[model samples]
Target: MLRCPNCNTHDIGRVGTNQFYCWGCFIELTVNDGKISSIHQVEEDGSLSSLNDLFLGDGEQDSISL
Candidate 1:
């Protein structure tokens, strides 16, 4: 069970090998080395926008999900 970093909810769906979609906040997360290295938002047009600056913590030091 993975927890969403944005909404802190354990409602994540695996969309790729290391990518996950957070239903809680509708954000996409990329996991590397057990940490969230990238953040993106799924837009209405099905485009992805970077949300790194807003939700990214110490990527290597912070664990955002399972």
Candidate 2:
């Protein structure tokens, strides 16, 4: 299973094709080609705030569950 690098939580639920939501931290994770291309936080206004810079490492590639 894909784990959240921040919270190390595995409570990820698929919200769309190749898109997953982290129930633990209430964030959105988008995986493409077995890599996470974007991370966003869902706001109360139903908007997205980019959280990639906080979570994505310098050379870390996105991960996918088998």
Measured on C-alpha atoms, candidate 1 has an lDDT of: 0.82
Q: Identify the runs in model 2 with alpha carbons over 4 angstroms from their true place.
A: 57-60
Candidate 2 per-residue C-alpha lDDT over 1-66 given as tens digits, one digit per residue, 9 for 90 to 100: 799866889898899998888888889988888888889999989999998887786957666663
- TM-score of each predicted structure versus truth: 0.83, 0.83
* Candidate number achieving the greatest lDDT relative to the actual structure: 2
lDDT tens digits, residues 1-66, model 1?
577767878888999998999888899988888878898999999999998877765544356436
Which residue pairs in candidate 1 collide?
A: none
Question: What's the distance in Å from true for residue 39, model 2?
Answer: 0.3
Candidate 1: residue 2 Cα off by (Å): 2.2
Task: Provide the clash count, candidate 2.
Answer: 1
Candidate 2 structure, TM-score to reference: 0.83
